[model samples]
Target chain A: MDRTAPLPLALLRGTATVLPRAVISAITAALLRGLLKTHPRLLENLTRLEPAIVHVIASDLPYRFAITVGRAPITLTVVDRIATGADAQVSASVATLVDLLEGRIDSDTLFFRRDLRIAGNTAVVVGLRNVLDREELSIANELEALCGPLGGTARRLARALEVIADSAGARLAAMHRTLHPPGTEAQDLTADVRRCHEEIAALTARLGTLESRRKRQADKIA
Target chain B: MSIRYLELVCPAGTPSALRTAVEAGADTVYCGFRDCTNARNYPGLNFDFDELCAGVTYAHARDCKVLVAINTFPRAGDESPWHRAVDHAAAAGVDAVILADLGVLDYATRCHPNLRRHLSVQASAANAPSIQFYRDHFDVRRVVLPRVLSVEAVAELIAETGIETEVFAFGSVGPMSEGRCYLSSYLTGLSPTSEGACAPASHVAYEEIDGRVLSRLGGVTLNCFARGEPAAYPTPCKGRYVTHGQASYLFEEPVGLNAIEILPQLKGAGVTALKIEGRQRSRAYVAEVVTTFRRALDALERCDEGTPTGQLHGNTEGGKETCGAYQKGWR
Candidate 1:
């Protein structure tokens, strides 16, 4: 069990480099189609946004995903060559993107931290974000559902990925700390802010704590 | 010492948010339809009728109540939408319908008299006479107070009105008269009262220039913040304007109102419920804020060391939280 293992992102980057582009596209397309099939309400909810193409770019990765919302037959496509003139573009690390989907992090908090950058039509972006937030999305649950019969294995693998992501977040925070050590009083303020960001990141990583919610309910019953 | 039982009413923009709030220990969850009939009528937010019915079922099974918000004013010629919303809410079996407009309230009173009605903060019913008007005419059971009233004022109103008083516990702090101010229409032709959104997203924009992010509404620059500085919704009231050769917040700064610390004072004030705003925000926001307040309220009930500390940071709109007018030490 190596703590600080940045596995998921590295694994995806490695697979992208080794696999043919067409094959990767086909796999992601199937997964996207499967997700839509399972979460029909999610697609219906997104249809309220004005018809537009939204680009989601993972700054650390070469690949980008573009989604068409509010139009008949919504589509999600993986692209390497960027398309121009998207209605809105949200660029962030894949981890942050996943957190946004899971609602592990509040988008406004991320905006305040500048961890996520959004460009283009503000209205479309706002609409898209609100629509996505409506769903109780879990990448692990989607994977399990996509793998019928082998769902347990998929669920276990998803848990492993989550563990790796949690540690990778800590490693990134370590790197950030190394880059900015405490200094003069003004710099100390910056350090304090950095610590707050780290705390928020830590809090976000531990968001799936259903045990406490249960405990609170139990306390009330008692 | 016995702590008064104060209900926690929370906002849920979507079906998922409603469930989240319920699971997070909200005594009651309030939501709106996906149309202009409600105040949080943003694109892609809120429930359709079917979703609302399902949400009500989900919440009732868990002993949590659901309230539908028909808080926005209906157009003069088009009262059907508002009227239809009340009918739909009644059909959905919601606990109550929170209303603002006089015409719509009258319709609910006459058409669906059995349905419980609550006065929305949008009505700006800050005084006993105004709240009593809704109570006597509409049979309103409760009134959600505006953020403008002080603790003393709230106690007085509760005593006079003799209605269930719901005060804001947490969320955005608005300075203008609720449900009445049209300062936003000056900037964007869409009426906040009619459209149900202040600075409708279509008219909102953000730009980065010279190391600052400028929030503009209807092409009018509202506030420019340095990189990493907290930004707020570019509504007219929250804007920073240039006056007297100095750039300052002309009306109010972009800050969030957090009254969790003052629950004791409110409970003593004979408040019935505390409402957490932000029906336009994410379900994550709902989960976090609801859970934090739930714990604080639970602790208050047991009279433990209060204020579930460190849980309230970085969870506000303007990136800052204030006690707001509830404890106006400056005033």
Candidate 2:
């Protein structure tokens, strides 16, 4: 169990890359179609904006997706190669994108943090962001709908797996910290000096109180 | 003792929000279609045709009135959408269609003669002559008064026009005349009057620079909030700018119009309805505001004095509230 266990990046990349491009594209198209069906305003808004090519790239993986808007029935496609001249290009980690789809993180905050990169046509990007923010989107719910009767069971199993993975990761990090300490001598010394100063202050305050009490007794005796 | 309860007009951004307002004791709930015909033409907001129909049915079942806001000004060549929205609203059996444009009102008057029309606040018909013109020409039954008018002025207008008047009781206070502000359009090339969205979400962006959050509309910085301070809607009018080496809210400060404590004064001013103005907000917000106002109105009807003031501090913009023009004279 190592804290420096490299985030299983290879495993994630392998899983993403092994999936067929057609399958991924089909899934994305189907999910977006379902979203439009539930929320028709999304398509209507896209139609309002000028026609543009938006390329969405997963920064941590070799995956790129493009959506062409400015027409009725917006289209989504998976591009095998990076787009060279997209009207707007949005790049983020797959996890961040998932969080966005789930409405778990604020897109503006991500953009501000530079975790979500947008280039080229900013108006289109802003339009897309606004449209997306107007609704509560959940990819898991769409997938569950596709699964029918087994959806509940699948969701429960997924939750259990997530819990197990989180606990396992936390335990591994704790063990790693025990093996390799923070090793900051200066910080420790600073803490010690701070404690000593606090003690001295307290003792001086106590001495003042004692002197006041002794002066009262002396005054009474005189 | 029989007391007339002030009609509580609330905003419903979605179907659920409409239902929430009704359940929370809204006398009337106003909403718009999912297009530029309404002032709150934000994405994923407002109702579609089916949703609007269902909402009307739902509100009717609950004995609550549904007002459809087709409040935006029609574009030069494209008046079809606004006309269709009025037709749809009438076809859906709404109690009233709130309108701002002159041409749209004429169309509504001619095509749907039986339908009720209310002049939208966007019309900014502050004076008696302007309001009388709408009532005389288009047969507008009600006029949602602009926030610019004082309570006394509102009472005077109502007395002069003898038409039903609705004043803003809660929500963002706009300094400029409604339906005429071009600040957003100047920066974004989209007209607030035509697009029905001021500071259209498509043109708004927020960035954190040196621990300060800067809210921009189409590349122009509108407002900057220090860390841990509450942020407001990114409208150009409420932006803080540098003037004479001092950065201050030049046009207007961010404060919500709250007439909760002055409910009696507004009711006394002969206001037919008190409008709560947050259609783009969530149902939770709708529920909270509607519920608080419902209680205050109930208490007022019971002849109780001293309405609560700080009940809505948390919900207000920048966590501050003011009676706005209603009490501006006192200051």
Candidate achieving the largest DockQ: 1
Clashes of each: 0, 0
Name the DockQ score for candidate 1.
Answer: 0.37
Name model 1 segments beyond 4 Å from true: A1-20, A144-222, B1-4
For model 2, the superposed segments whose C-alpha errors exceed 4 Å read: A1-222, B1-4, B303-311
Candidate 1 clashes: the total is 0
Model 2 lDDT tens row, A1-222:
122222233344455688888887787788788878877767876777668888988877676888988787698888866557678778788878766654455454454344666656656876675556555566667655666799677666655666677788899999998998777787899999999999999999999999999999999999
Against the reference, the lDDT scores of all candidates come to 0.83, 0.81
Q: Please give the lDDT score at residue B262 for candidate 2.
A: 84
- TM-scores for every candidate against the unseen true structure: 0.85, 0.67
Candidate 2 residue B32 Cα shift, in angstroms, is 2.4
Candidate 1, B1-331: lDDT as tens digits: 1223679999898888898999999999999988999988888888889999999999999888999999999998999999999999999999999999999999999999999999999999988888888899889999999998889889999999899989999987776899988888998899999999989988888777876888888999998888778777778988888889899987888788999888899999999899998898778888899999888888888888855744665878667888888888666
Model 2 error, position B40 (Å):
2.5
Report the Cα lDDT for residue A204, model 1.
Answer: 76
